[model samples]
Target: MGLRPQLMDSTRSQDQDQNSTQDATALIQQLEQDRAWLLEQIDRGRWQEFRLDLAALERELGQLLQRASEHFSSGSE
Candidate 1:
């Protein structure tokens, strides 16, 4: 009985870890796509479009930084 509960808890932990890994991978892919799009816009001499993309990337980066900070702070606590 106790073993069954432990097994379920272990499985849940594994699933949570896997989900976090998938989320990180997706974020990296999104950042790469955004960077490519920004470069293309800049190469085309579309300053306005470039600015928009740059702003978006900056926002994404800022969010990621905040998330990392929060995770680390919580871990320490």
Candidate 2:
């Protein structure tokens, strides 16, 4: 019984980790897509709003990537 509970906990932890990884990947893809769209808008000279939005997006994307890197690396260790 004790060993079974430990196994269950380990499985749950793995599921949570997998979900987190998937969520992070999806977020990164969406952010990249948004960046591309914003860039196209900026290129067309829709300057002010899109540029600001892009800057904010870049910052968020950077932070998220850093966090994801840390999370995965820590998991490996």
Candidate 3:
């Protein structure tokens, strides 16, 4: 026999939770590294590279927000 429906649903939910937690942790680490890189750039006066990193940071932040929203909605359900 196949897995029970409830068991499958629970497993799926757990997987989502695990993935979401990992994503959030990785995002936080990325942000910290970005912060350090920004400071280093500022000290070195690398304005051009700083601007490039800023653009990349925006993308990372957007992805983080999207993942957080998905996780929040799913967990609340």
Q: Largest lDDT belongs to which candidate?
A: 2
Model 1 reaches what TM-score against the true structure?
0.57
Error of 2 at 74 (Å): 10
Please state the error at residue 9 of candidate 1 in Å: 0.6
Candidate 1 lDDT by residue in tens digits, 6-58? 99999999898777766765676676667667667756777774677776776
Query: Tens-digit lDDT track for model 2 on 1-77?
Result: 67999999999998998888778767766766776776677667776756777667767776776677677667656
lDDT tens digits, residue span 2-66, model 3: 66988989999999988977777677677667767765675666777567677677567668756
Worst 10 residues of 2 by lDDT: 68-77
Model 1: residues with Cα > 4 Å off, grouped in runs: 48-77
Q: TM-score of every model?
A: 0.57, 0.66, 0.52
Q: After superposition, how far is residue 29 of candidate 1 from its true place, in Å?
A: 0.5
Off by over 4 Å in 2: 48-77
Task: Please give the lDDT score at residue 5 for candidate 1.
Answer: 92
